[model samples]
Target: MKYKTFALSALALAASSAALAQSSTGSVTLYGVADANVQVLDGASSLTRVQSGGLNGSRFGLRGTEDLGSGLRAFFVLESGINLDNGSNGQNSFWGRQAYVGLATPYGKVSLGRQYGSLYNLSSDFSQFSNNSFGASTAVIGGFGGYEPVRGGDGSAATNGGPTRINNSIKFESQNYSGFSAGALWGAGEVAGDTKGNRVADIYGRYTQGGFDAMLSYVDDKANTVGLKTRTVSGAASYSFGPYKVNGGVISVNDRSIANADGEGYWLGGSYALGQHTFKTQYVESKNKGGLVDGKTQAFGVGYQYDLSKRTALYSSLTQFKNDGNGYVARAASSLPANLTSASDRDVTEFVAGIRHSF
Candidate 1:
């Protein structure tokens, strides 16, 4: 397999910013992705738009590691999202995407800061679409479909599909043993008066051997805003044979109180690579099992990618959202397909052609 990554050194930036300890044993690197696309979004009306991140999100980040002592290292990362279409920041926070520092030992690694929840990390691998705004089920399942920019923000609890990134969190992951490993996280509730305010946590275990991979995950969300409690459990798997690879997963969100609704979603996707070109297809469907929420969203997408080089690629995809059942809008977690139409049951179509470069 051949892939590309773009990374810059931090020595230059460090030279001007701070004095480096002559004895310090560590290094820093800067890296990011630049991706942009043109799309036709057909919502209530037809709209043409230029977008960023079709296959992958664009963002720049700084990461560093320092040798602390015998078999120990201190590490940190500061990452931000980018929107090339408008030249705007991706995440709301300056380093909204990720800002964390941790220690790595022979046995495991532990860190504290804003970080990805267990479920999100687990889903990224098994997911064929990976919650892409356009081609992924994660978009509709977790409300990532542009309708909510802050799906995991404070005050919003248990309403999301996949357990998203967490803020003010502590996490631990055991060193990989063979082809299996485990990890857990605890996001602290920062409210002074309330101990459990905005607190969340998750745990997951994964195994991979040869071309087969699988995972089991659990999420516990306890938000103080409305005292809403959300619990989730999921299982997923994937396999690859020759030029073809297949992936699938099932997720269930248990939130039967406030909204009196429990959400469930399933997705399956497959791809085949022939030389420099790869073809893709996927389907995602989600619904709330109870409460007044009586709508579900189903999406189907197909795309092609042509490798321009090891560092860049040109790609295109066409996706449709069937806002069937009740009155669900055609949307993704990060980007909406077209826009929502006046009729809740209307279908939305999306097509994108784009170029992506990594550095």
Candidate 2:
């Protein structure tokens, strides 16, 4: 009887040890975001859209990490975009926005799959909208410019492909060093028999210390549709003093295929918080060089938000855009337009008011 009891105890101990080992080795997490809004566009005519992912892109994702031990980890992320309005899949892909597997260690992380470029991440980090919001001017100022035509064969704006995201990418992010971090990404063109010239590369670095922050980025793409290689460089800084934060940045783009096609731009933005109310404003300008015509444009916007609860808020924004030179016009691609000239000339003004909730 004593021998049987001892053997049973030993078996239990072994099982417990195996369970602990498995638990220490890996974990998986499920996370998601949902955002929707009813919006109106004015300018040339009145139009309305029930939009999903207003404040944030709606998405659901699974993320996992396995400890390889010795401070090294194997990780993966598979995220799918979702349309909250109709409870449908966004982009109709299982892992549309982000699908990557990589390794992480004290050195940093190396990931391979569809992902954003380093320049995109750096600019987004410093922008007030961070590539969201109806008032975001990143696309208008040519800061995020690329070769993909805005309109398709039907002359309507194309949705499937654009500059905002990238595919077939391998990226590396360096571990933070003294409050500074850097990253680089390369997108494979995957063209058979030719690999060198048909790709994109981007690099970015940033420093943050105390209440001050700064960033810089550069991107180059040769496979763009116009057969023109494009290069962009941008930098910005921000400071926080008490209840207010002020930030600004400058961006420049060069297009080799289009004559007079170089462009430079700058932005200044700030926000102030007072009790339950926050006020924000920004101004942006861009100038084109050696293009068909010297194009120039400017934009100004202001916004306010009131917190209703920890997870809910009410917000409103007013913005306007002005353009000059031949073929220069501003169009409200994201929100309601404000004036008739903008409607006829492709210029735009917009206002947005909405409520947002998060969990």
Candidate 3:
């Protein structure tokens, strides 16, 4: 969305509100997902625990819109992330998931405030696991030490995309023209004296036709640290036929924080749905091409789901992770204890069973 600001006089505002009260239309909706799971981890250490967000994050949100005439609408969203396991803020801030206000025009949408990056939003269309944190999720395989660039120590820039959200940003999204749409976002650095430090820019294009969907994304982030920058390029696609679906994607990264550091990640997966039962499997890999970051990992995952109703389901997944290099230390699961570590050449096995409901 494109961001625009306007100033209104008190008399004008009062007159508009009075007119809106008489003729304007608007609506508000409350929605959320409640998802949790029991997990077992087997590697250098064994542990069992309950976790939040197996298939989806646990959260609640409010969204509303007002008709502003002329095919234009004003809208706002306030979404908060939750940790069901402990009842704590999932993102450490209220409305951490999304908080934005924007205007929707005939041509496109423009929004301002904290929002998601285009790449992050596009991944859902092509992710077999719906971009969740379980199974063979891309989130697990692509951990080249913070592939998702967040605000640095100086704290000037918003985080860049790895399917992660960005703060202090403005976004513009084009209306779908036939089967294609495009979007771009820019986050100002707001540095004290520097114009370029801690800034992020992202852009993406997508297409959908019949049962096929494809997308490409690019991101550039100037970290708060001096002389460091990160860039990412990604492409993904998915197709569906009958009750079956297939998905695959690749991401390449060049992070200058570590000299010569370059890496790539890829995944291919498919799913079949029949009646109330669905089955899926995926293989994912990440490799480092340069620098001392020997981040190489491979994983295979399989899962099953049984829908109990339109808004609830029972699901389970089994995955195995192989760390191929000394510098690659990610494990097989998400939200694990801080001390959990995977040694090079060691395999980490994970099992998860969960339930998810949405409103």
Candidate 4:
């Protein structure tokens, strides 16, 4: 009887040790964002359907990391988009937004699978609107033009190269040095031969010190579906002085399929806070040089927000776009139809009021 009791105790100890070992080496986390709003267009005949992520898209995701020791670790992320209004998938894919697995260490991090290109990542930080918010109109205004239809597939803009979220890609991010860091990415065509020319490549770098930050990035693609062969170069900077912050950036796009289709764009934006109220404004412009036509478009926006609490806020914004010469086609307005008549020429405007919460 004494021998049997000792044996059972020893087994229990061994099992507990194994479980603790596993817990120390790996971990998984679940996280997400939920956002919704009511939107109306000025030109529309009547108030239209309501939606979410109007200021920001809704999403959920799973992420995990495993310590491999010696400063090395394995990590993976799977994120999915969701429509909060109907409780349905946003892009109709399990991991349509981002799906990646990679390894990281003190030197830097290298990731594989699907991910955002260096150019998009860099540009997003400078804009007032990001993801699905009011700033999303930038895509149509040529702020960061490329193949944009693959991920959203709304036919509102040209497809940049692959999906905004790339596939079969390898990305490398460098460690910060003196408040500066850099990164590069390459997406494989997965075709038999001719790997270099048929694929995509991007490089970017940024610096941040004190209240000032700036970044530059470039992307090149030889043969992306949609016959999209493009090169984009962009940079942005911002500074905070007192209770106000100022930001600005420029982006240039060169497309192979269209003659003189190269374009350059810039934006100037700022924000100020007084007690519980915050005010913001932005001015953006785009011009096309060698395309079938020559023209320029400009957009102006203003917004105000009142924080009701740490996690909730109410906000309102209004934006307008004006086209000059042949540039009417390049205007960015939420009121414009997803499918515009090629022959029509007109200005655009959008206004939105909503509430946002973060948990």
The model with the greatest lDDT is: 3
Tens digit per residue, CA lDDT, model 3, 1-359: 12222334656788888977945488889999999999888876788898889888899999999988899999999999888999987655778778899999999999997787765655555777755677877765343114322212121122332235777779999999999999998876667786457777889999999999999988887755444576878899999999999999988877767565677778899999999999999987877777765767787999999999999999999999877766655655364555455453367788999999999
lDDT for position 16 in model 1: 47
* Candidate 1 vs. true structure, TM-score: 0.86
* Worst lDDT 10-window in candidate 1: 153-162
Q: Residue by residue across 1-359, what tens digits does model 1's lDDT show? A: 12222223455556645545633578889998888889877767777888888777789999999987899999999988888888777655567667899999999999988777766655577776676565654656653432321123331222222247677789999887899989998888777887565677789898988999999988777765544567888888999999999999888878734765677888899999999999988888877677665677778888899998987999988888777656444454345444455564377787888998988
**So what's the TM-score on candidate 2?**
0.83
Query: Which has the better TM-score: candidate 1, or candidate 4?
Result: 1
Residue 333 local lDDT, model 3: 39
Best-fitting candidate, scored by TM-score: 3
TM-score versus the correct structure, for each prediction: 0.86, 0.83, 0.87, 0.85
Model 4 misplaced regions, further than 4 Å: 1-5, 44-47, 85-88, 131-137, 140-163, 258-260, 325-335, 338-345
The C-alpha local distance difference test score for the whole of candidate 3 amounts to: 0.76
Off by over 4 Å in 2: 1-17, 85-92, 142-164, 224-226, 258-260, 333-345
Name the TM-score of candidate 4: 0.85
lDDT string for model 2 (219-262, tens) is 77665443546677778888999999988888777766645367
lDDT of 1 at 337: 42
